[model samples]
Target chain A: MSIKLTILEQMTQVAREQGRTLAPLRDDLALLDSGLDSLGIAVLVARLEDRLGTDPFTNSEDVHFPVTLGDFVKAYENGAP
Target chain B: MALPEALSLRRHVAETQADRFLFDRAARIRIADLVRGTSLDGDPTALHGRSVLIATASQLTSALTLIELDGNARRLTILPPDIDGAHLGALIADAGIDAVVTDGETPHGLHDIPLHVACMPKVVPIDRGRPEHVRTEWVLLTSGTTGVPKMVVHSLTSLTAAIAPRADSDPLVWGTFYDIRRYGGLQIFLRAMLGGASLVLSSAGEPVAEHLLRLARHGVTHLSGTPSHWRRALMASAIGSISPRYVRLSGEIADQAILDNLRAAFPQAAIGHAYASTEAGVGFAVDDGLAGFPASYLEGGCGATEIKIVEGSLRMRSAALAARYAGARGASLRDSDGFVDTGDMVERRGDRYFFVGRKGGIINIGGLKVHPEEIEAVITRHPQVRMCLVRSRSSPVTGALVVADVVLKPTCVREEGRAQVKDEILELCRGALARHKVPASIAFVPELAVAATGKLARLS
Candidate 1:
């Protein structure tokens, strides 16, 4: 599975746990404005680590935090082996 | 001025106000009988000036024998009875131990000095002169994060410097959740002796409810435990029945939630939490029913200790600092000005400074830092969490993510109830914490294992 899809699925799981429903994902979607909060982002990161076996954010000394869904997915792609 | 001639434990026992100084469930031992029992070993003169390892299973026996050995001027290293045999041998060799005293069968290849042999009735009229004024060193084992326990050396006088002198007619029955081998437990053991108060020793492998009932039966007025121990005991139905005058929390970060819960549970108890480590010796304590000490304490407001913050980590220097780490030659314990970096990260909030967590334990989420303790404090405030351990989970995108293992209240056991409880906890975190600080995932645990020192076992 793609890291981006895995991240989205985990975020959806977090939303469902909180009893919230998220709309279908899009590249231009503002992640912070989504039903997921900062904690949701954190949970998404953890889920992605489990699926991909490496955390790009921790590996890279200097990496920018993603604001939009496209950038978030790109961050995972760049961190992938 | 030479350390006030090192107060002898034999003299202290002789002058104790309490007739019954210790209760070990099996018997109520009087101080006089304890003083007289030292003669059963014939003469400890040969054992004097030797380094002895006392690894007795019984707390009372260890305390009694420690007094006798210390009075006879023997350097002592008190090890927990359950210590691994290989590790024990290594420690013995490292500390240059010449003899050992045990209540049980002695381990092979170690010279056994029979201190318990004297506990029985023997007609040996051995007079070991008046308690000598000599420096007696105590080596304590620290349960370091790296798994290798460090031997911390301290003198008996330095260990008891904070203990107040015995007062007239003060009948304080002391109780503690820690085993006597640990530094936290030894403080309470010494405190009770120094104040001439009776101690209700909690035996190892006993249930919290059972210990609380025993303490209540003994009319224990002073009690101490780590915050994790207190939270577990608070869940017990028997907790509300015992009323203590003095309550202390140590060996762990005493969060505001635990402090507030303790305050509500024991309104009359003077709730205080102390900060002390094996190498750091005894630090200051906060008693205002608050999470942390006042910011004013940083500028030498806490007795003779000088406290400072070096890049977010708390550092301390005091007269009670350990002389040196045993077996580690010429290792610098303190900086040039004598301040020891405590490794505990502290943050200033208005007028108070709160311990966030250990510097090494912080979780970094995509460049954002979050303290696991801060998340734990929030989750435990929900009233359903009996105890919780927050740790980091590696993330592909973020550097690390927060995860927690929670032990819920007994009533919230059913699958349906647990689900609802988890949801409620998530909502609580959403409201009470930043998004990054909330745990990414939480697994409900049947029980959390507490370290021998009574603190929650930090999951690596």
Candidate 2:
């Protein structure tokens, strides 16, 4: 699966497991308001780390924490290479 | 009022019922015979008034040596099975050990001790002549959060202050999953010795199933282990083989889930969980089938032990508390008022107080302190979850993030709704815990590693 699809699927799965309904997985949607709290985002990052074999958040010291769905996926894609 | 003469362990053994026995996996020896015989191949008088270290490979041999040397030696330091090898030199120097006792080959790092005595399981019946008047100082090691373990000093009176001799004439067989060298197991050993009860002991490498079968074979009337030890026992198929009349738990926070599960497993047993530590002696035990003790325990006093809470940590003051820390690295064991500060943290809820976790075990998430045990208590409440470990995983976003490793019941593991079970557990955490305390992810594990201390191995 593409990075975007994997992130979106994990986000939905995390949200559903937490008994929360996701509004949408649009690129422009604010990550904070997309029906998941910081805990959900943290879980998503951890799950993504398991699937992709790397954690973009921990790959670099000065890397920014992504703010939206698009930035989250891009962070992984850019850090992948 | 006249002060009674202090009694040593050998004298206590001489006075107890003659039929009591202490059994390990391989051999069973009558308690009375232990005092009549000696495991030391060397002259017993050579060890008198010398600081001796009992560093044996077998718990049974250690027990035999302790029985022989308690009053004879000037100082006897118990060396636990799980002590790290690197700390031995410091320990020997710290305790001022002059003589060494061993079962087989001398334990590594103790070659330089002045006197080396070889001990074997087989007892030799020799007249170990006259008793001495010196009150022996007993030294026990406590595992600190970092560095070498501190040597906690105690006398026979302090160690056995909480143990009350049983009045019943029936043969009460006691068994425990803890090594007798540690404080918890030592208490059980002392109780069995002084109360005229037979004890079934645990070895270093014995499997849980085999231990349960042995306990069953001996017909263990009273059994004790940590909550972690009991959880592992409950998972074993041989759990139904033993029917202990009394069950006790200590050495860790006994949560409601474990207490309730033990009650279901042994409905006939009077289940209780006690609070004790290497430094504080034994504080109290709650036998009303509850997780924590009543809030009244913190009032004026409970029995002979006075309980007080200073800054959310439990502090106990009693004759049972250790006298002081030994060695040059030793510090004052008690506070200004002679209270031993047990590092366990408890929170008051209504008329009772519950242990949250160790004060040193808190995980920092986004600068907020979270106790992993609080989350574990919530996760293990689910019927499908057998046991769980809540730990902190380093996170880039927040300094650290919480995660859980869960072991499901045998039946539930083969069930179809694994994802659904995970969902329910996460939902349970979401409802009961704060956002930060909720585990960011959960992983299903077949089993969790228990430490040599009979507690969960929470390795960072």
User: Which candidate number has the best lDDT?
Assistant: 2
Clashes of each: 5, 0
lDDT of 2 by residue, B14-38 (tens): 8767778888999888887766788
* Candidate achieving the largest DockQ: 2
Error of 1 at B369 (Å): 2.9
Model 1 has a DockQ score of: 0.30
The weakest ten consecutive residues by lDDT in model 2 chain B span B1-10
The candidate 2 chain A region of ten consecutive residues with least summed lDDT is: A37-46
Report the C-alpha lDDT of model 1 over B1-460, residue by residue, as the tens digit. 1135455776666775536568766657676665545632546665677787876668877887777777565578988755656566668777888777666566654544433233222223455565445567899887664544778888877677656565556688999988878889999988887777888888888888998899989999999999988988988998977999999999889988889888889888899999998778778888899998899998778986789999999888877788787884426778888888888999998999998888887778878888888888888888878889988776644657788899987878789988888878878887988767777777899888887778788877
Residue B448's lDDT within candidate 2 is 96
lDDT of 2 at B76: 94
Candidates 1 onward: DockQ, in order: 0.30, 0.53
Give the TM-scores of the predictions, in the order they appear.
0.84, 0.96
Error of 2 at B414 (Å): 2.6
TM-score of chain A of each: 0.85, 0.93
